[model samples]
Target: MVVGARRVTRLLDAVQLGMVVLVLVAPVAWMVLSAFKPRTEVAALPPRLVFTPTLENFAELFQRTDFLENTVNSLIVAGGSTALGLLLAFPAAFAMSWHRMTWPATATLFARMAPGTLFLLPWLMMFTALGLVGSHLALILTHAVITLPVAIWVLLPYFDALPREIIESAEIDGCRQHQTLLRVALPMVAPGVVVAAILCFVFSWNYFLFALVLSGFDSKTAIVASFNFIGEGVTNWGALMAAATVIALPPLILTLIIQRRLVGGLSAGAVKG
Candidate 1:
């Protein structure tokens, strides 16, 4: 009876897993396939499962638009925001963990939890008044608001898991606060830092509204540029799909490269040792 029950549970789990995969993977698969499909076939009734793939959409994306340039812009903003978030968050998280400062962490969380649109108008006016509208610097700084809270929250658990004796020993060894953070606590939480950085980069890379409102021609992100495919009467579905596929590549590659580490980092703080 127990063996039969176990088999039923396993079968249920497999069914749930397959459903989840289908829901997530189907759209991505369709997008990638459509990126290579001819323009006429993209929205064809009853999609073509067997069709000759072509590079025309990709060529159109690169040659006809500033998508390549916009991709470079996205990279710059995402990388900048990730670095800035880590720099600020690492020490902040360590301090919060060490001192048991819950309020500050809560404040940061509140900022994150608030609708992003809430800050948009204020930021727009402030940047415009500072003559900073349409600059990559503006995008990076605004994106920091998105990345900072994520880094802080992700790293906080890792810092909380640190042994008190290790921190006390560092202090006893004459390491100052900054030195302790930089040399001791920082090294111990390296996995958490990696996870935080990956999340920050992914968030900033995909963020669109800020870039759409603030960016100039020179600083437009690929996500914002992809909107060009949509017009009043005609939507370039194939080209849009191509742009999306390209935009999704960097984060996908980065995640794939560090997948093992990412999984380890996420699970590391789940249980105290």
Candidate 2:
């Protein structure tokens, strides 16, 4: 009976693991499948698992809109925001770690937890007043709020985990504070920075609300441009899915390439602490 019960538990555990894999893969599989189907086939009363696949949706996505340009815009916004946020957040994270300050970190947490809408109105009004509305700067600035917080938080734990003795040794060796940070501390925390950068890039790339409100025609990201798929006359499901597939490719490829490093980076501070 004990052996029988153990076998039953193992079988149940296998089933649970399979369910978890399905939960994660199902949405992505559906999206890929939708991107290939015809509009009618997508909404076919009884869903068809297989059909005639066509590239017509992709052709339409590229031909009917500025999809390529918007792709470049997403790259710029995400790249720029991640870089700038890292620059600003690194110093702040270092200070917070050095000082052992919790209030400052808590304040950042509060900002992140607050209703996003609450800040939007005032930001819009201020941007409009400054003639910054509908510009890349406005979008970049709003993204910094998101990117900076994430970068700071990710870096904080790593910074705190570093040896105070090492820092003191560097100081004794006549390294200037900033020099120590740049040469000694930063390299040790580089993996954490990379993890923070990846998170920032993904968040900035996927961000819709700020781009939708703040970006002009020249600066609009692929995510906002995909909105064109929803027309007043009719929604083009196939075209929308195709655009989504194309828009998601950059980050997807990016994540796949760096996934190993990202995993390592995330584990760095935890073991040290």
Q: Can you write out model 2's per-residue Cα lDDT over 123-155, one digit (the tens) per residue?
A: 989999999986777888889888998899889
If candidate 1 were superposed on the true structure by all CA atoms, what would the RMSD be? Answer: 3.1
Write the residue-wise lDDT of candidate 1 on 1-273 in tens digits.
999999999999999999999999999999999999998899998999789999999999899888889999999999999999999999999989889998987899788888878898999999999999999999999999999999998899899999999999999999998999889888889988988999899999999889989999899999888775564222778988898899999889878867886777658646632
Candidates in order: C-alpha RMSD to true structure: 3.1, 3.1
Error of 1 at 205 (Å): 0.8
| Clashes (N, CA, C under 3 Å) per candidate | 0, 0
lDDT leader: 1
Q: Where's the lowest-lDDT run of ten residues in candidate 2?
A: 227-236
Q: Runs in model 1 with CA error above 4 Å?
A: 1-16, 231-234, 256-273
Model 1, C-alpha of 63: deviation from truth (Å): 0.7
Clashes of 2: 0
